[model samples]
Target chain A: MHAIKTLSLSILLGCFSLPALAEDPADADPWEGFNRAVFSFNDTLDRYALKPAAKSYKAITPDIIETGVSNFFGNLSDVGSMLNNVLQLKGGAAGQDFGRIMFNSTVGLGGIIDVATPMGLPEHNEDFGQTLGYWGMETGPYLVLPLLGPSNIRDGLGLIPDSMVDPVAEVDPIRTRNQLYGLRIIDTRAGLLAAEELLTGDRYTAMRDAYLQRREFLVNDGKVASFDQDQF
Target chain B: MKKSIIALAVAGALTAPMVAQADATLYGSLRIKAQKLEGTSHDNLNVTDNSSRIGIKGSSELFNGATAFFQFEQAVSTDTGAWNGGRLGNLGVKGDFGTAIFGRIWTPYYSFTGAPTDILDNATSASSTYVINAHRASDVIAYVSPDMGGLTLAAAVLPTDKGAADDETLDIKHVAANYAMGGFTAGVSYLGFPAADVDVMSAALSYTAGDFYVATRYENRDAGVNGPTEEDAYEVAGSYTMGNTTLLANFINDDDNVDDVISVEVQQKLGKQARAFAAIIDSNVADGGDGFEVGYRVDF
Candidate 1:
């Protein structure tokens, strides 16, 4: 309950900074101060509580079970991605994601196994944030949310609408839903454990820039954008 | 479509037997360049096939937790449409005990000294002219230790027979060790021809982060014969990738009458499998030699 209150408070604070993000500067980060504070809070929480839990999860879970859990979550994400592809009007990608979902859900035994990839139905990663960007939304100031983590204005807004389309969000039995959500978070964090060794420089800024760059790349779909003439 | 079908048929026929035995992969690269060389005496222009090669490599699991692998690579002259001589041929067995291989292979010394800094497509890289023992040797046997915490040691020997009346002698010996950690690598290599009275030693270090990669190499050579000729060479190279283009540059100083060379190259990626590149090489020797080349390369 306390964690939920903190999460809601962070969202409220993040929303208050959106206006400043709109009117402020041309740089990628306009809410550096507030974002830094949130980043510190998130980092402290990760270092103390979340990291330990993820470590324990990794140590206790067998490899095959962990892989099955990851595959199940991945199938769930693909379902959301197919909807996002429709919203973005990417017909070809939507067809591919649709094919993936069909094959994986059936042959893969409720997404516990991944037999589709070897059959050459490659994964397509689409999200509501990418959909917003495809519709000509400029990624606003980099913001760090409390429990949700790094995001921008458009992507943060995207979460609200996108969550409604997610089947997991509609699950009955509040305890089960909460447990699933918690497991997802823990699984994701545990997956990133090996990557922590590569961190260098200022952790907060490095992570922020990497996140923003990756988001930009995904939004552009591996294409370089021409320079905006007005910037000259 | 007809030509592609014939080509595919030919390739399939050639690889059919290998495929049945192991996981054979038919891979090749086609690199053709239009080159111009300028010297103090004359200028020249020619189209050259820059180490274009096709190879088949495969590996299969052996009994007792070991794996057996073999590779046969042959150079092809794209300009003349002719198959050149073999580039590499070797068979090996690898397991936790490490790898043991025999036949034509690159000496560990060549890989340790040259691999890090030679980023260009063709002859422009200073290593071609500056480094003496950069070429591969035939009749070779090599052993490589399994990686121990990112550190690996390798040793190779090239044995040659002088004539029918004489026994085989190990003419060349090479030993190298490399350590790699998080996009950073450091290596040292030594090459010795005891019968020929020549020795070469080199050390190299490289680091890669984000869009930039940089490397430096230092080498010393002692040709004990011919009035005790001794020389040293130093090279520094770097490359930066920005979007679809990668810019590369290298400088080498061979300590023989202050001879030096500098090369710059730019490669633009056409797609996933093809790239077009241009390079210029300038040498500061007294004779004044330089070259310019434009090339396109495709890998399959």
Candidate 2:
């Protein structure tokens, strides 16, 4: 306990002594003109087609069922997250992901109920893109895919491998796989409805900054040096 | 043909905003805590939701120089998968003449006095320290005057229910005013419950300089039959922020009922909208032992 107290004091002192190292946001969008066009295309599609479907899905689905669907997909994503953690050489996080998968698959009744989080195995969002970033690959230029919305060159390429490992894509029957993919899309979109309020100023800029910041936060494991602390 | 198509798409993209409808922003924070509370007789571990909420708010131009706004916020329970609805559901108009809002909303009294020490993520702060006035009340018509030379005033009335059997209409009224100068702020608030013959008066003073902040509040409750009669409460809290980490401590003494409570917390910011914290609370009241909590919060 004494040693722990001393270590805590040292960390507190170090925190107070550290200097602020703020960095300008490196948006690095050379293809803004083209990206904006594609963003608009995706936005229009989302507003007309996908958004209404997601809204309807949210309206019709019971809360417990919706949560179960989300949890099922989330549990599946952990397989990829675990793989990425291994690739990034993060043994601890990889172990936690493995534990989450095992526990949730069985005790959680195929992840319909997320029993892992309550057990202290927190969720993580990891992919090949973050693995490449951990290995010092640059983000490259920002790009807005035709239907994928915001991404970068590195992440766009990472998507291919990610898709290959995606459990839903591995479903034996093509029809079932396609249906699962559709449900996942709608569920993901519906989950984001509550977050739509954070958008402010230019929609494009806000979306771009938020996406980039979120990517960076995930890549760095939430240790962000350039964060404006006073914004809160 | 591809070049022409690209040019046309760009044109459409640039002009899309002109045809867009007014959008309401949806935002929320999700906070969950795992805690261990040890009392004189029992100890338990539990997972608790700490005021997780989602809200949609928007404003529309009503006329020249006048705008109308509305918000509907609801509480969510992540632990139990239940929703406690209608934390704040209000509609108002804002312009040079000041703002008037009606419906269920935060009371001006609590905003002025209780909010100073309400920094912690759990119930150990405002809920435990200050219990004189309701944090948010329903059926309230509130008006806040525009800032005039660093001073702002607000008042609210909860109209009586004449048709109801209880006839408690116009029973509650609240008034508050705050002043700010440089790094220092001071505020006072009053809540009156005429039918119950109860009244609460509170004052708060706070100062912030760079990463350091300190605040104190004092409250007095007049004689009342329904609750604690002629009670007084005092609270003081301070916090220091260092980069992404903050250290906070607070103490409260309620002259009646709750006794003395003290809490300390450390919070680390994960990003602009996410934080993790660990806190401990110790209460002097009988069987009101010690509680420790660790939690993470994400706001979107």
Candidate 3:
């Protein structure tokens, strides 16, 4: 029954991703399942906590690590190209340009900064699970993968190729590895970082739900799913 | 050639029924952490490391040998309780002859030493310590060579899209070769960045045993086209895996001449997805005793 529930959810989520299913996205945006619950919690935090605290703390507030992390991923544009080979995506025309730019910026500069596009190569979007989907693998079940957050069986397995090509994960020194991950959470818990003191609601539930919905939006390329439509 | 490439992608897409493979699986890890380190050199004092995020990558094949691939990853942090990370978002694409992408991409000159650290694994003083990070360059593009045996070459170019005569005119390029047979693996890479025209060569060798993989590497560099010359670099590391448990340990040396460094790190993976890590780092030079760091991390 649990597996059935997960599968049902996966199908519901999966169906909404098709370019065809988005015809009536107004009623399906921010689909329910795990995402709906997360949206609700994030809304609650914004209403009762984060918004109120922002006015006062904004002045002295430190920025979140997400910026760094996003930069980290943004910096290594070639990772997508490597994965594209394994997944077989539609990027040949641009892959060379993209790969050239990423390789030049990252490795050439000791990864201190990206020198990819400013040079010449164009950017490309690619990954494994998408390759699997393009290859015919079923999405399996919609699962909130414990701490790693949102995922379906298909994407879960997709990690294999991503990890395989990830230059950071491939780095050896504990220093470089740790440094890459060094600023991971401070920014993640930005709202919670300072406001851990002002909570009137269940923080865990609030965080967990918010996390799940965020993943859903991310995984679906910002497209709104069916169940998410009912929410305001 | 491009036609055949698209044909292949389209063929791959055709094999997979649209309904069964509709939405690509979305996966990524969000790491929320804090790190403080004391170091010499550079103006930033008692710098606080900021590294955290959540990203998504997916792809679908077209009937003409083309595959639709993309990724959306942003800094996931608590600023205003919304998706906020100065790094912005990124996307990618790949097919036939090569691949292409957009969004923030890594600069090549900086990517040479992809992994040359000891015990720092993002927990200690070493997390944000590298000298090459320039944040994410926008409107970026890149490419790679199809593997011929263990040899695959790649390169990237960055144009100062800002439309300025004196805008950033730096060019970075790199090529890497890797080989794997049974449990033994080895790799060598080269980098040439002309903005500073620093030519560098990095090599790595390793082997795996019963959940444990050990590696050693060395880097020889000519610091810049005309800047002060720096030191050589070297390191050794090992990762042990048993079931869901993997342990990592390493010792590293970055003899940058100006401010040399020696460090160590030990980390235990609770599972493939999460790890608890710790490290100690120190840098000594003409100035004086430099720095140190210690911490733990959990990724989701």
Candidate 4:
């Protein structure tokens, strides 16, 4: 019994003394303090303002109308996606995006319905950020934009060029354009309501890490270092 | 018409950029198994659901680096097409200090001790002696300390509502400590049923080296004022992975019950979120029998 006790003590001590895994990369978030403050501000605004508004919008809208609104915005975004795919030299993806725009706009009643997907013309979410990443630009420091949430130096810069070609931004008459932007924002947030349950751990950290990992996944077209789908 | 419209809406949401939002995450696993059992009078082939479940979890920053979180999980019966089994529902807060959750929860005793050797996706848990303790329970309040070096401590209490039993407010209590470093982990746990004056002690050790993993557990239950005096159980399990394929084996013995179980399995990974597996199990009890099973699991 004494010898058994001694063995157990030794094993316990060994377990405690074993080395730990390496720490997270320090350079990933050089501006963590500022970024955290911005994240908090954005989170507060989302909780108090945007989320409630989106919830109300979803509550009032019919499912068909909601889907139509989302599809319309999606159809418009395909134009920019096609441009970005061409810029990144992905001919197949560019063609598919072009096909989606034409099919959805014509047969689908000005994009109010999405006939392209059922017709095997899948949506490709190409953007200027992904184009830059495909051309070998490194994602710099993580940043949390006010009200916009997680981003990085490269993607943030890419967003400027992306906005220039945004169909909503190009809409004539300031009032109509602003209304379209507001509707799009509410629809997007409402669409995310069902997905919110996937978040885990620290809200800020989970969002940041997911954003970074997803960006890498997109830029490499799903060729990620690790693909553990069981992780939540 | 409504269903088609809803389906389209779902498709649109699924194609959206998934990682930009700060909200709860929804995830699930679906597993179904086909099996054949032998050495039993009514031995037959059966298709069964294997603990498939879906869950939603979220956390919100509270104050001073602390955050509040909640999770709700429910089992889905794939074979029967039913979805009414509740697995977990808990709310908690955590920070540098620790985590405290109250609701239905997996017992610390099971997590620290039984989990090491409860590796088989199915059949093994029911055939093994680790069924001595309740794996999960409602009305549980659990606490887990933040990691100190490689050591972590956890505790839980199950309280009975007034007038529910013989006035024992504290129905069951559990305490556990675990140490994890690199690829090695060790744990010890103690559980007590105050009303019955029964107690259990268990220990587990596990190691992972690259593609190989092994674990062992020992448990002793003192069934005071209950039955069978004392029961002791032990189990050992091991697994090896090569590329997308993994092989696993486990053996369990209950000294008091004179029961023994042996199980082996081979699993093949399909992409990132899906797997197919085949298993064989044999147990030496009156109704216990040999069985073969094939299953598929996918998670999202």
Candidate 5:
């Protein structure tokens, strides 16, 4: 568990700091103000909110995994695409579907292909944090979310990339790169399987805050000081 | 009159061999475009893309870790409730062995070699080419193998659903292949029509050599109506991302023996859900050339 947290932290830091390795602080990113404001708003969420909500994420890890697998299989429409190009495999009775099944077995399930999984194959693990960091974004303010948890501007930007890699995100890289595509559906589902129980408060507010703070942490890589929600 | 519907029902029958589980899902893309037309002043370009569709897909866990599944797809036009043709239907089953789709779906033929959307503001009407036209033919089935060390194989057959015809009898058949790994990807496909016997072959290659994405496609169809009748299309497109804006540019060439055409497009996005796009196309046929056209599209 400690290793997981540490690794997550390292990845968060690496993704946000890449592009600005040498740039001067003077350059404003145009949307920096909106970024700052949203960043501040999200951070407040943690102080007045999320740490308690995280208990739910912690409890439902298994369900998150399940839905994650489903999502992975749902997107791999092109698994059999390549072979059809070289051979004129007609569509009817001679239907070809193994490409899809195998993809679902591996990528969808988070690389636990059972058979395919043994080949040292691993899941194409993508999350909101890694997404923002990959895009050369910077982790801005340190914020304690209302119902979510710690976050910042960099994390907010990270949401775009995270959603980009999200199994549900319509765009891809995450779409095609999912190795154990099918398993991811299950893994993500399994991860959140328990959340269904604790979802009482303003479930909407809780979810909104949790999602925002998570995105914030992903972008900032947990680098800055916590935001004071009282200011907002 | 209702051959298309019969063909559609027959497709559902094909997948019956495999037992369906609760996993089966229905999904598809729906697009409605309004544009301006060229030569024939039809006023606005009330165009519906062959791209619009809906499908049901799902899988069941079989014994010994194997899984069985199937998918059925249909062309759904917002402009018109009726299907475009046989090219729109597809159904098939998949197991640990591989995936097979029958009825009417993307032929491995069109999967790799279909024409680009850039040729026309809309495929149903303004299409400068018919190489990937799925509406003209029907009753096709295809199969794809499981991934082999990241490589997979696929093929399809477009059977002649009709008994026989007097003047025009459409009998279509085809095959195709694709390989993608890392940043470099390449694909090729071919389609054959037995009656008029028009054969269309298409190939696409896209490589993400870094931050920029470069893609190109070349397709040609022998219309057969006229000796050496040509229905060809080509596209050269590339995109680059800077901050929130992803800039895209594309150039296309469409030739159908009847009309020789060229088009260009540029697009930008504000974020994930919104975009601004503009394109211009010029067609020069065997007869006279229809100057130029400018167009745009947005997604909700």
Candidate 6:
């Protein structure tokens, strides 16, 4: 019975990814030129501005304080994660995610400390882009937004509706909200500092391929059949 | 070519029903753990992503009665949304005689050194202290012989870094063999890094009957290229399952470390693809050194 429920849930969730299922998406980049151009722009901005700012932030901020800032943002994202889990009909996971928010908020000292994980309630990551892909929607075309970097037509469009559900969208005073948004972006980039060294080859192509692969992984909820093989 | 095509057509017609059902698959597990450690050297509480990983794999029958397979698995951190790294990214072909593969995959020695006893999900686990995890190799080729009466042999070779700017050496090799009969199984692996001082040899033995199972592992690292340092470790572990619950315990002894741990874990099935677990570890080297964690694994 439990197996049946899990299978049905996967099937329902799998519906969104069926359109492009057999299409052999090994070379899914149709907008390569435009994407590369935008990617260059994003890269320039990162090299000139964002990366430096992040470095400065890293140098000035103490490690514990930086972790707290990350935890705060993480706690905020849990609201969106809970909503997506509920939408996917994962009631148990949704409940746990909700518990994460409550515990991290109160006992964790307003999300500065993560007190929920040791309690056996784990974090569930979800987003509107993944939700759309869960509904059997085609990933559409590859895209690179001006500042957001790698994305796709479906996920790029998802940002609009997702904002409607974001708690930060409801914050008063546009300046304060903008400042929070800036901090979130910087914090996220800072977290990726070590991983940047792993990137190899053409920056545009590398980022594009990684984004597509990651999106597919998310859409399938980390279940995908191997389609390519290498031999000695 | 025409004759081969005809034969393939005949074979395809014969297996069309099964062929139609063949498909690739993607699967992974997400595990997040919250842990508290109290020791003379450390006292803190934190949440961690405990080896959360995602992977895709599949195999297809070829016309020549061989199967071609591939898999790509990578680690993802749930707490901080980081890409930890890649694992088991390889492709291979299998047939009646044996199987051959290339690309990054688990070293044959890993099964002997870590697979049996590294049951707990985090650094507090015995593996951190007991296992020397040279568990993966890149740009290598490997082969596994067909099982003969419950016995199998495997070997892998990593080539030299000729393209590297440095005068790096190569010819690293790993070999392993395992035999299983009835309620008992045993395996040993030798990893030779002739150019470097990090050669490791390990072995594991296990037995299971009914709902109870136990295993032991040992590993020795030779001193050479890096420094005049040699290290060795041993571990013993056991587990029992009752209904949907499992109880586990493991102890590690290391020659180089001043701290060692003995841990006990309780894991409960939450669903077909989910589990909740709690573990506690006691330290033998430090005064007031102990660690506790509760965690969950959600597989999809």
Reference-based lDDT, each prediction? 0.73, 0.76, 0.48, 0.75, 0.46, 0.72
Q: What is the TM-score of each candidate against the true structure?
A: 0.51, 0.53, 0.42, 0.51, 0.43, 0.50
Against the hidden true structure, what lDDT does model 2 obtain? 0.76
Better of 5 and 6 by lDDT: 6
Worst 10 residues of 4 chain A by lDDT: A1-10
Candidate 5 lands at a TM-score of: 0.43
RMSD of 5: 20.3
Which has the higher lDDT value, candidate number 3 or candidate number 4?
4
lDDT of 5 at B136: 38
Give the winner by lDDT: 1 or 3.
1
Residue B230 of model 2, lDDT score: 78
Give the TM-score comparing model 1 with the true structure, all chains together.
0.51
How do the residues B1-300 of candidate 1 rate in per-residue lDDT, one tens digit apiece?
699999999999997875346889999999988666676642666677888999999999987889999999999989789999898999999999899999887667767767788887646474543446345777889999999999999998877422223333677678899999999999999877667657788889999998889998888878552225787777889987755556678888876534678877766567788876666778765543586666778999
Give interface RMSD for all predictions.
16.7, 11.1, 15.1, 17.6, 17.3, 8.9
Listed models, DockQ each: 0.01, 0.02, 0.01, 0.01, 0.01, 0.02
lDDT of candidate 6 over B1-300, digit per residue (tens): 699999999999997776364467989999988777786544667777988999999999999999999989999998889888987799999999798989988766775546777676545454542334357667879998898999989988877422324334555767899888999888898877655535777788888988788988887778752236787778888877655556678888866456766887766676789887766678655443576666779999
CA shift at B18, candidate 4, in angstroms?
Answer: 17
Model 2: per-residue Cα lDDT at residue A66:
98
Off by over 4 Å in 5: A1-232, B1-21, B43-51, B80-88, B115-129, B132-137, B149-151, B161-170, B194-198, B223-232, B242-245, B257-260, B266-276, B284-300
Please give the range of 10 consecutive residues that has the lowest summed lDDT in model 6 chain A.
A1-10
Ranking under lDDT, best-scoring first? Answer: 2, 4, 1, 6, 3, 5
Which runs of model 3 end up more than 4 angstroms from their true locations?
A: A1-232, B1-28, B32-50, B77-90, B96-98, B106-113, B116-120, B123-129, B134-139, B160-170, B195-197, B225-227, B243-245, B257-264, B282-300
Per-residue lDDT over A16-77 for candidate 4, one digit per residue giving the tens place of the 0 to 100 score: 22111112535678898999998899778878988899899999999999999989988998
- Which residue pairs of candidate 4 clash? A196-B24, A196-B25, A197-B24, A197-B25, A197-B26, A198-B24, A198-B25, A198-B26, A199-B24, A199-B25
- Per-prediction TM-score of chain B? 0.85, 0.87, 0.65, 0.87, 0.66, 0.84
